[model samples]
Target: MVRKQTELPEAVTIAIASLRDGEKSKVGDAHDLLQDAVLGRQGCLRTDKPQPVDWAEAAWDEFITLMAHDNNHARSIAGQVLSNLAQSVPPETALRDLDKVSAATRDQMFVTARHVLQSMWKFGLGTKEVRRALVAEFADLFRISGTEKNPTLRRFDIVTGLRALFDETGDDSLLQTARDLISLEDDPTYRKKYSGVWRDLIDR
Candidate 1:
């Protein structure tokens, strides 16, 4: 589905170039290119290899500034890229930018928000403090997003993110918090739908 070039370094280069264009209101191309680089095909990134970490880390400073771009599109892409680079850069960088990435979870574009939240696990990789913070952040967001119109799906997405983190870290606290959040849903049908998300995790 991603028509863009699949090479990691090349993709990061194109994404950064598009980000520059984004500053000038030329985000259409940049947004699309970055999305392909981040999302890849069938929800899997094309450049899922270890090499992308170096390329992504090289562009770290650019991403930090881009996360603050006036364009939400740029913020969305930057959040995803920074998350991807978390494994390569100092864990502190990701920890420091956690707020910026978390803010993207509330982006007006639900899809953009979902992307940021989904990739957040990268921020916590190999770090317990960051992992605990991430779980708490999602829990807080899960509690807050309840005010939104379609809170059920929002909560479900939060659980999905938690599952990813839990899978990586094997932290029971994440699982407990995920279950706690799921219990908050009022609509029985929707609650049941969402509970199915935890079935495997709880069973495990």
Candidate 2:
């Protein structure tokens, strides 16, 4: 007979302590237990049947409460938890608490990914897919760039996305324009983002 996997008592302790709403803090022992329970590496609380999916839901709720914990550790822990959820596929679970996630991601790009997720609800984002989809609407976004009513989207963040948009829309001219727009941007990261595509287009 096979021995059953132990649901470490620590797992329950952490889950209970982490249940406080707005109780942000750095990853503590509770987070570790949560991670183990959900990730299954450290130890599956119930070996009989893995509880990663269930653990994930509880973690999500706990993460929201931790968002306002007023502690760097708590915020960071919560951020990682949410990021894991965003990156999951077949989406072991759907983010029913989208509004809360959105609010949390507003300050940190790490968290801001949740905002990009808005696109996911409609389309999806995985670097390639998001860039391709974003291109279809690049013109609309660009149209607002220099206007009074612009949406204030992070243009730098949209460069590669626009490149993809151009690819799908067959708007080569915009590629040249994009190259010109970023011509003076000193940030190498921004240049690295799409300069290759623009340079390749110019050469072609």
lDDT of the candidates, in the order given: 0.67, 0.44
In angstroms, give how far residue 5 of model 1 lies from its true place: 24
In candidate 2, which residue ranges exceed 4 Å CA deviation? Answer: 1-27, 42-52, 85-95, 108-189, 193-204
Residue-by-residue lDDT tens digits, candidate 1, 67-101: 77777777777777777666566556657778887
Q: What RMSD value applies to candidate 1?
A: 5.8
For candidate 2, write residues 1-204 as lDDT tens digits: 112333335564465466443253423565666556545556422111222343344345556676666554455455445544432322322334444543443444433333342222221122334333434344334444444221233444345444544554565655766766666445687556546656677445
Q: Cα lDDT for residue 41, model 1? A: 29
Clashing residue pairs in all predictions, respectively, total: 0, 8
Model 1 alpha-carbon drift over 4 Å, by segment: 1-11, 23-52, 55-57
Model 1: lDDT equals: 0.67
Best by lDDT: 1
Q: Residue 187 in candidate 1 has what lDDT? A: 80
Superposed by TM-score, candidate 2 places the C-alpha of residue 63 at a distance from the truth, in angstroms, of: 2.3
Alpha carbon deviation, residue 64, candidate 1 (Å): 2.4
